[model samples]
Target: MKKGNTLFFKTRPRVRSYAAICGSKEKEGVIGNYADITLSDDMYGESTYEKAECKMLSGAISLAVEKGGLTDCDIDAMLSGDLLNQIISASFAARDFEFPFLGLYSACSTMSESMLLSAALVDSGFACNCVAATGSHFASAERQYRYPLELGCTRPPQSQWTVTGAGACVISDAVGKIAITSATLGRVRDWGVTDVNNMGAAMAPAAADTIMRHFKDTGTKPEDYDMIITGDLGALGSRILKDLMWEKSYDISSNHVDCGEIIYKVIEDEFQGGSGAGCSAVVMNSYVFTKMNAGLYKKVLFAATGALLSTVSSGQGESIPCISHAVELESLAAGAQ
Candidate 1:
């Protein structure tokens, strides 16, 4: 049911299983130990970085379905996206699966968008089992958004490294570790940030907008959630979001954690931190899921933010438009239904 700016699912769809797959550098990061698979080579022995990204996404989707003790035939639908133009990675990967596929595009917020659709489908009984995933490749994104790999261009201080990874989750009717209860769809917000190099600042306002709306719509305090996780905000954007929350008289400092800030180690030389479609996807499916299963987090707000500016739009001197989608996840023991 729609509640103000949020969608509340009475029959919360359970997250039966998930899988996280990444490259070598990501494997060396904080959530590495929790990932289902990590490739020694970022290329994954593929001919190109784009192909490699498709492979990681395919692997994640297959692993997630397998983890749930199901196969492609059992999956009713597959929804996924990537940072690439037309979401080529997701579309190309979907070719391997016989199930119905829906290619989505919400930049880095793709994970939340895909998950929201999956939860709605499962909760509505439109699908018995659904898989939603997203991914990004460093080489691929760099070439498309910034410069080519051959340029060896210097990155600005505010720039974040695009994580070479993928993550997938299986949403089913069966009660499981965690269930998605609500989703807050964000509105596009342009804060007049024109610097394409600093995605953090460009996307911060949207994250804050969604976060505040979610709290208001649900009549919940920031303290109500065990954790409030944001996607690809890095350090600067996270701070901006906190400031915005404070302006609204809510202190989210205690439980807020940014996926970008924690995905890589501090000394990894990743400037701000990780940013990409894969950052939140991999971290949530791995670290967050593992924590929920361990009973460490009873309630979590997963808000994935995205900068909706394309290369053409940026080149045309258009301010970056950003959005965020938040999903409320709670332990099944809470009796969400």
Candidate 2:
């Protein structure tokens, strides 16, 4: 991946439409205490995470396929993943569609990883077209990770709330032709922060390490890309990442941004920082896709970061481990026109 040298692969079909499907349950302004989360009688029933993920994928995929004027059979393959065990959300969602399926898991980085793989498959002549990725979130993640919201537990500022929603995207070899061109995967890194109260502190090193490697491997300067986005490193993590980069003299302060910070506007007081996997997924579909279509930015770097620690892992006194996957997206129409 030489920088400044244009590298080309067979272009995957353009992304025609992007959509987000979220649960109707209004959990806004419900914070600080764990007891505020209402699990029962919710739209997703007992399993809020998997159910909402499936619903969001169904809704987003239906809209994308419909808007793109594609039949179910027209989809060459479905590449999907989620945070659940065995990826039940993506697997169940794929069952409702007619396309061939590939289930993937990379913890929170699943969305970007799936998108990168889909783009590779399509560009490498392995598939004609593919629906890239989707993700879901539920209150259950909290119960499994920290404490059930129903327990009224107090959360530290470093903790990020898992969102209760889903997001999806459709990628193709044609239509608008905004396709992923390249990607970089980061090795897992542990900064030795174990409290989990502040994920930014734990995940910042991984984000910085990956971002630097991406530039090194690709030989692209930070200014070359219009925007450099990270997955779920909310306010705390974003700041930590910037500081770490500066310490290494990489200084990407102007272009660096985090999806976790963008998803929810009132992030400061409400969420302490921002959200989870759904954070990057929803922001990508709802915000970045629109901007790309509008021709606001030509080249963008999306780095989705994930912390690879379970409650058990943390409980066993293991350090919080983090990983990141990055993809480059560009508009073919803009370049052609």
Candidate 3:
């Protein structure tokens, strides 16, 4: 079951269906067309930005369940997380669903955490259907982690834009074209990076650690997976991870891609790019999964990175500890292509 820091799922529960929903800014990103629903208004009709994030998260869950041909009653459990105090976005979203909910908080890496937990539940015969979801909002996250939106504080070149979106996937016991085969749970790594604004630097070490462990545990190499996509860690972090892996004699530079780097358009002036639970969640379920469904990709290793830093920790001048969780997604029909 557990090898090194990775978990090899024997059941291989299928990701039956999924949905990615986002706002106008994300709609302008590279994979915008892949999103299931793109709203013109970032608010989604909510009075507050927090409430809007809640809407996006819950809406993604409902959308995923519906697309999977299941209703709320069929979902045995819901696993979710977000970037907010007490993770209110996920908890508030859970209020709209009937299933049991578990609020997870792993910073931006929560999407992979939720999915890994959901697959484990189904694999253990504890649940037949599980919904894994998470999200974040630029407005809500900015005020909580950095500054208030009204202040209009200037963002640094190294800073990442918290994606205003949510993504959800319905994992079921029923066999499907796509399945989660394994997961590499990350260990917290701290490189003494204290800048809260530059999350990519703070999280890249964890990403490298998990990737190396995954290859060792599974007896696979960089070429085993078609693509190795990291969650956030934006542009600079991706480069750092590559350098670190290269130092370890594992060259992943060729097939490696960072979710943050590709999430937005280069012309958007978003600096490095997007970072949030929603970044990888939406990108995988929408863009990456869509490509897999089309038989364009066979196997992918999705590593969602997160900086485990609290506002209290940052305020206290503590270094940021980071983590990443990698899930292996394989397409059943890839050989047919």
Tens digit of lDDT per residue, candidate 3, span 1-337?
A: 9888788888899989999998788888877899999989988998999999999999999999999999889999999999999999999999998999988999999999999999999989999999999998988888888887778678788988888889999988875678899998889999999999889999999999998999999999998788999999899888999999999999898899888889887725778889988898889889988888777888899899999988999999999999998888888865524
Off by more than 4 A, model 1: 333-337
CA lDDT for candidate 2: 0.70
Lowest lDDT 10-residue stretch of candidate 3: 328-337
lDDT by residue for model 2 over 1-337, one digit each (tens)? 3243222345644677666654333224222111112223435543455575576666667766776678888888888877766778788888788899998777777778777777767777777667766665656466566676678666666667676555667777767646677777767899799877777778788878878887877777888888999988888788889999899888789998787765554675536455566667766766677777877778888888888887778889898998888888886656432
Model 1: residue 19 alpha-carbon error in angstroms:
0.2
Q: Rank all candidate structures by their lDDT, best first, as comma-separated numbers.
A: 1, 3, 2
Predictions: Cα RMSD each: 1.8, 5.0, 1.2
Candidate closer to the true structure by TM-score (higher is better), 1 or 2: 1
- Top candidate on lDDT is 1
lDDT of each: 0.93, 0.70, 0.90
